[model samples]
Target: MTSTLFRALLAVLVVGLLVGQSDAWRRRRRRRRCPNPTDALSGAQTAWDATFMFECPGAQVIRRIRSAHCNTVEDRVWRFECGTVPGVSRFDEAFWSAWLNEYNGVMNFQCPFNAIVTGFRSEHRGNDRKWKLKCSKVNGMTTFNHAQSNYANEFDLPGDYTVPSGYYLRGMHSFHDGRRGDRRYQYQICLIDLP
Candidate 1:
């Protein structure tokens, strides 16, 4: 009888151990499925353009962007790196306003799927000017966004412009000034609300 009781206790202990291990496995699986923000940016791909439109391929969100004037030409160039986020299968169709004739105005674009503006690219030539915005669906986010454009000259110090309390930087455009032999900047920022 003692031997039988020992076997039964051993069985109960083994079952408990198995159940605890299964719970741990499930927790690990859940963590693997839900990606952290940094994890979403780990597998990034870079796309650059001088005069053409730059778009992140297929549902990926832009994670970083860099813009500067081209060294050989009197034009601006931009590079954007993008990545995918787990559990976000697809993004809303990107939308942009018609290319305006002037470059220094407020350009606004909205997403139908309630996505937020993640990045932007602007084209500024003599007579042609336009902006393209990249959108991504993030959790605890809202729609109905607006962008404010600020020039470097607007601030006392260059590159010292501060983002508004609830806004974030979305795009940067640089123009080469032949007279100054330097580059000037215009920054586009979008509003965001935190929950």
Candidate 2:
């Protein structure tokens, strides 16, 4: 009967649609190194600012933070919220002291830039988002020539920034001179986009 044929055709169509969807999913799973479903949901979240540094091809986006350390979510949020460089934290008291002695006391400056300076920041965080590390006191060094950059940031120390885990350092980049002066003191950080 035509009625039976109609039902049969409908079932076949449904099956074909399901098969196509499954194939697409399979293809996606195979393509990415991290087979985790969460990873699939969160694609690359990198973003960049148009005008920070002229040449930072490595990170696709880079911006400077003379005082604000956007490496941690806490610092980033403060910078984002105030739209200025965040003041040094209680945790950074030691660094502030050392820095003051190391260099001419860096004024409690503001976060400088707000966009990624480069397109290539490494993925330091895993799927977790709650890393409870703190910024430490750095001594005896006015300029740290870490892989971060040649320019020294008033806020950037080194190692284990207290950014929450799983959150990832997605698109940091704060500008310097929270006080406002010549842009020469400006520093930049280009972040890899977060999910």
How would you encode candidate 1's per-residue C-alpha lDDT over 1-195 as one tens digit per residue? 999999999999999999999999998877645233233333223222234556667766555454333222333334455655444566544565344224444443444345645555556554223566665655565533556555644211223344454454455465444443334555555654433
53-133 per-residue lDDT for model 2 (tens digits): 122222221222222222222121111101111231211212111111111123222122222111222111211111111
Candidate that scores best on TM-score: 1
In model 1, the clashing pairs are: none
How high is the lDDT of residue 166 in model 2? 17
Worst 10 residues of 1 by lDDT: 41-50
Global CA lDDT of candidate 1, please?
0.49
Point out where model 2 deviates above 4 Å.
Answer: 29-195
lDDT of each: 0.49, 0.26
TM-score of each: 0.42, 0.24
**Per-residue lDDT of 10 in model 2:** 97
